[model samples]
Target chain A: MLKKRIIPCLDIKNGRTVKGVNFIDIRDAGDPIELAKKYMQEGADELVFLDITATIEKRKTLAELVEKIAKEINIPFTVGGGINSIEDVSLIIKAGADKVSINSSAVKRPELISEIASQFGSQCVVVAIDTKFENNDWFVYVNGGKVPTLLKTIDWAIKAETLGAGEILLTSMNNDGTKNGFALDITRKICQAVNIPVIASGGAGKKEHFKDVFTQTIASGALAASIFHFGEIPIPELKNYLKTQNIPVR
Target chain B: MIAIIKYNAGNTKSVENAIRRIGFNSIVTDDISTIVAAKKVIFPGVGEASSAMSYLKKYQLDEVIRSLKQPVLGICLGQQLMCKHSEEGNTDCLGIFNTKVRLFPPKEIVPQMGWNNLQGMKGDLFKGICDEDNVYFVHSYYAELSEETSAACDYILPFSAAMQKNNFYATQFHPEKSASVGEKILKNFLEL
Candidate 1:
């Protein structure tokens, strides 16, 4: 059986891992390479590096950072933010990321998903959807969840899969920083709607929240940022907890 | 020199980086002699079966790959192409392993992506690895089990996780992306 993945997402700004990563036993949590190596040692199933600073110059730095991380760690590395074209995807993948994720660009141009998939296989492209529950329905958001669109979350997910997207990284805006738990309702809805793997993101506060996301929904992976960054939930300990709960986790 | 066979596939750069990280240098090439003369050849690919095979045949690299005498390791599509045939595109492939690749049942997830544990470990490829150890996999098609099967995994149904026949070794999973355990496996293959 395939094990459910536990991913620690890092927000990178100006080529550095932004936000406080409060893990002990390490001096500089802000360094992306150092934190990535540590996380791999701690048994993180995968790592997602979201470059918040998506400028032309910063993308180069992000690629360099990805190269450094790739040289040090062997885990699957996913990079997102500012990927707009086939060239952008090629640049990052050439820099050593296993997958390139597109959110804002994908929303603006749905064909971009198929373009990357056709050029670099579906497994190389990951479409990220930032969704918010609005007016009794889950709606898609663009530009880092600041803009809302009329597109329904379930509808967009199905469309992305048909566009040849291999995986969907679904994030709930309402639960993003709340850390209460995953948006189980929407997560399960998207998972059931698509055959491709859905990675549930946002609203992960405690270890139990991780277990809840896995047990309640069919999410192939759960992604968190602050909990892992602040040392509140070490990946090894979290994996141990999931194992005890009879959850199949790597 | 360690040479990685290049074709119309993705993930070759990542594979090269993986090799470099383990304190070895490698070249990515489709040239027949470079691949044939290398101390070891890592055949890795991530693309449509028919197109990739077409690319291989265009350059006549398929014959060079088959004629190679050094230890060869194939990853994902590399392993599938080593089989006799693949349901992907109803394509025929190099019959080095004497196995066939087929698509997962429609009811099951098309691509059994993410980490999965391995059982029935055998041969030098799994030297320091153990049964039930986790490795990363991302594929919709799988190779049927055969005498060359060194390890097995159950996803939708039992299939070959790793296969070995003489000097030819292949893994359906991406050891390059599987972290420490995967690194160890690659190191084992390099040392072999």
Candidate 2:
């Protein structure tokens, strides 16, 4: 049986980790490499680095930072944000990322999904959809949840799979930073909509939220940021809880 | 030096990075002589079967890879191509393991993506790795269970998660992306 993955997402800006992580025993919360090493030690199944940095020089620094972290961490790593072209994907992957997540750029040019998928396998391409329930319908939002498109969330997910997206990182904009729980209703719907694995992101407050998503929906993974960052929920302990609950976690 | 055989497939960079992370140096190469002379050759790939094999045949890499005596580890598509045949492209493979790769039944989810546990693990390749330890896998087709199977996994059906027949070793999962358990497996392979 395939295990459900627990992922810790690190927000990076100016080539350093922002939103000071409050984990215990971690001396430096700002160093991305240090934070990454700590998360790997804590049994994080995978790591996602959202580069919130600005400028071309900062992007180069981000690559350098990724290379440094890649040397230290051995698990699967994913990088997203500002990745618009094949060169950007190649640079990040060469610097040691296993997969690259695309959002705004992919929505603007849907073929970008297949374009990257052709060069790399679909397994290496992750289409991140930021969605919000609006007007009684789930709408896909781009530009970091600022712009809403007429495309429905479920429709976009099915389209992405057809365009060769291996995985869907479905983040509910309304649930983001809420620390409530994952958007189970929409997540379950998308999981049923596509055959590819769905990674439910945003609104992970407690360990039970992870459980709710995994048991209630067919999501293969759950991604969280502040909960892990603030040491509110240690992954090893969370995995132990999931194990007891009969949820196979890695 | 370790040589990761380069063809049209992707993920060689990740493999190379993993090797480097393990404190070893490796070069991604397609040259027959380079691969033949390397201490350990990794035939890692991720792409459609027919085209990848065609590229290998075009460069005469097929003959060179077959004749090499050094230990060769194939990952994912590399493992599929080492089998006697693949259902993906109806393409005959390198025939190193005598196993036939078949597509998952249509009723099941086609690609068994994400982490899966390995059972019946044996031999040096899996040294220091625990049975039922989860390893990463992403593929639509799998090599059927056979005498060469070193590790077995059951998803849609029981299949060879890892196989070894003499110096030709292969894994249907990506050890490079499988975390510390995977790192240990790679380290053991290098030490072998």
The most accurate candidate by TM-score is 1
lDDT tens digits, residue span A1-250, model 2: 8899898999999878999677667778898988999998888888999998756667888889888877788788899998988888888977878789999999999999999888887888999999999899999999889999999999999999999998999999999999999999999999999988889999999989999999999898999999988989988999999999999977
Worst 10 contiguous positions by lDDT, candidate 1 chain A: A20-29
Instruction: List RMSD in Å for every model shown.
Output: 1.2, 1.5
Report the Cα interface RMSD of each model, rounded to 1 decimal.
Answer: 1.2, 1.8
Query: lDDT by residue for model 1 over A64-179, one digit each (tens)?
Result: 88878877878898999889889889888888888899998998999999999888889978899999998999999999998999999999999999999999999999999997
Worst 10 residues of 2 chain B by lDDT: B105-114
lDDT of 1: 0.90
lDDT for each residue of candidate 1 in B75-162, tens digit (9 for 90 to 100): 9999999999999999989999899999998855568889999999999888888876899999999999999999999898999999
Question: Where is model 2 more than 4 Å wrong at Cα?
Answer: none
Put down candidate 2 lDDT per residue, B8-92, tens digits, no spaces: 9766877887888888899999888889999999999888898899999999998998998999999999999999999988998
Model 2 steric clash pairs: none
Q: Estimate each model's TM-score.
A: 0.98, 0.96
* Residue A23 lDDT in candidate 1: 68
